[model samples]
Target: MDKLRTVSDTKRNFYQYHNRPINSIYRRVVEELMVEMHLLSVNVDFRSDPIYYLGVCQSFTQFMNGYTPESDKDSIFRALCQSIDNNPDEYRGKAETMLNFASQKSPQELINWLLSPTDDNGLQDVANHWRYALENPKFKYSRLFAIGLYSFLAKSDAEIVKNEEKFAELITPLTDKLSLPIDKFKKDLELYRSNIEKMTQMLTVLADTLEASKKKRQNN
Candidate 1:
C-alpha cells in the first residue's frame, strides 16, 4: 500500500512547486488548506466527493487570489494536491461539474434531488453517499464539508443564499433531513465568509503598499 503523506511532506511538495516562499499574509491560508486536505485524505469515511472538492477548490481560489508571482498559482495548486496523492485537475473538474449541475436546477429542484433516494440523475449518487455519511457516526465532519454544503446552496439559488431568513429556511429542512449539526454548519460558513472578506481587505492593503514602494523606488 502507498504510504500516506504527512503534513510536512505536503508542505515541502507545495513549496517545491512554487520555488519561492509564500507571502507571509497568505501562508496561513495555504497551510490551513493543506492540513485540512491532508486530514480528510487520511480519513477512511471522508470520501472525495464533488461537494468536498468544490469546497477545496473554492477555498484555494479565493484565498490564493492575490498570490505574488501570479504564474506560480497553478504550480502551487498542483503541488498541493500531488503532495496529498490527489489530482488538482480532478478537484477543479469535479467542482465545476457540481456547480454546473446545480446552476441548471431551480432551488426546489435542487432540494428535491438532494432529498431523493432514487438514482435517476447524476446527483443522486452523490446525494446517496452524503446521506450515508450523515447517518454514520464515524463520518468525519470538517469545515471544508460545511463550505461545500454552502457552495451547493449558493449555486442553486443566489438570492436565497443572500437573504439571511431565506437561507436559514432553506438550510433547516436539509439539516433536519440529514440529521446534520445545523448550528455548527452555519457557524463555520459564517466564519468562512467573514475570513474571506478580511483576507480581501488585507490583500488590497498589501497591494497598495507594494505599489507605493515600487513608485518610490522608481522616483529615486
Candidate 2:
C-alpha cells in the first residue's frame, strides 16, 4: 500500500522546491490545492487524466494570476506537483493535448464522443475512460472533475457555455445520460465561475490603484 501524504509533507516539499517560505496570503491556496489533490490521488477509484490536469492548471493559473514575485509562481506550481510525487510537465503537456483536441471538434462531436465510444487513440482513449468512470458507481467524483468537464465544454463551444440557458441545455441531457450528480456539478461550476469573476474584478481594482499611486509619485 502507498503511504498516505500529509499536509506537513506538502508544506515541506513546497518550501524545499520554492527555496523559501510561501507568502501567507498564498499559503492557504497551496494548502487547499494540496489537500484536494491528495484526496484524489489516494482514492482507489479516482483516475488522473488530462481533463482533470487541465482543471488543476486552469484553476491554479487563474487564482494565482497576480501573485507577487511572479517568478515564484512556476516554482510553487512545480513544488505542488512534486510534493504529490507527480510530474508537473505531464499535467501541462497532456492538458495542452486535450485542449488542442477539443479545439478541433464541435460541441456535438465532443458530446457524442463522450456518450459513445470511439476508436481508441489519443482523445478517443480519454473519452473511453471517461465513459467507463461515469458508468462506475464507485468512481470518486470531485470538484476538480466537474471543472474538467466544464473546461471541455467551454473549449468545444465557447458561446454555448457563456450563455446560461444554452449551457444548461447542453449539459442537462449529458449529465442525465452519465448518471452524474447534476445539481452538485452545476453548483460547483457556478461557484468556480463566480470566484473567477470576483478574482478578476479584484485584480482590476488593484491594478488601477497601483497605477494611481505610481502617477502620484511621479507628480511629486
Candidate 3:
C-alpha cells in the first residue's frame, strides 16, 4: 500500500533542497506568503487544492520570471480540457470558462497575457479568477498566489538538482563519462578551482571597495 504523507513531510523533504540558492529563497518566500495568508484568513491548501496548487505554480513562475514557452499555451488548454473531462464534477465549469477565455484571445494575446508584468493588477485579476473557479474566495494579497505557484516549483527544481548530484556520484568509471582519463579529470578540476579562486579574490576586492565608500560617506 502507498503511504500517505502529510504537508509537513513534504515541507521537511523540500527544505533539504534549500542549499540550492534559488530554490531555497523561493521556498522561504513561499513560507512567508503562507504565513501572511493565514493572517488574512485565506484558506490555502497546498496539498489538496489542485486549482490553487496549479494556479500557484502558473502565476508564481510568471511572477518570479515573466516568461512562458510559446509552445505551452495550446497544450495547457488541452490539458485543462482533459482534466475537466476526467473529472467533470470538479473541473467542468472551471475548464470551460478557461477554454472560453482562451478561445477569445489570439495566440499572441495569450502569450502577452503570460508575459504581463507581475505587478500589473490586470494580470493578478486573471490569476485570481482561476482560483475563484476552484471555489476559493478572491485572494486579498497577490503574494499569497505566488506562494501557491512556487510551492511545488521550488521543490521540483531542487529535486532535479539533487538527482543530478546523485547521478554524478553514481557515474563510476568516471573516465567513461568524462571521455578523459582520471589524471586529465584531476588537471581540469585544478584549473577550474584556480579560476574560481581568482573570481573570489575579485569579489573580495569589490566588497572592500564598497565598504570603504560607505565609511567615507559616513565621515562626510
Best by lDDT: 2
| Clash-forming residue pairs, model 1 | none
- Ordered by TM-score, highest first, the candidates read 2, 1, 3
Q: Across residues 135-203, which tens digit of lDDT does each residue of candidate 2 receive?
A: 666656688877877888788788888787777777776677756687888899999999889889988
Candidate 3, residues 1-220: lDDT per residue as tens digits? Answer: 6445444443453345322323332344345433432333323432223333343333333333311343433333333222212222233343333334444554334334433323243335444554343342332323323233223222323342235344233332322422324354344434433543664565568679989999999999
What are the per-residue Cα lDDT tens digits for candidate 1 across 18-97?
66777777778878888889888888877666667789888888888878778877887887888787889878876886
- Could you tell me the TM-score of candidate 2? 0.85
lDDT of each: 0.77, 0.78, 0.37
Cα displacement (Å) at residue 149, model 3: 13
Which candidate leads the pack in TM-score? Answer: 2
- Using Cα atoms with residue i matched to residue i, what is each candidate's TM-score against the true structure? 0.83, 0.85, 0.24
Query: RMSD in angstroms, candidate 2?
Result: 2.6
Candidate with the larger lDDT of 2 and 3: 2
Q: Which wins on TM-score, candidate 2 or candidate 3? A: 2
lDDT of 1: 0.77
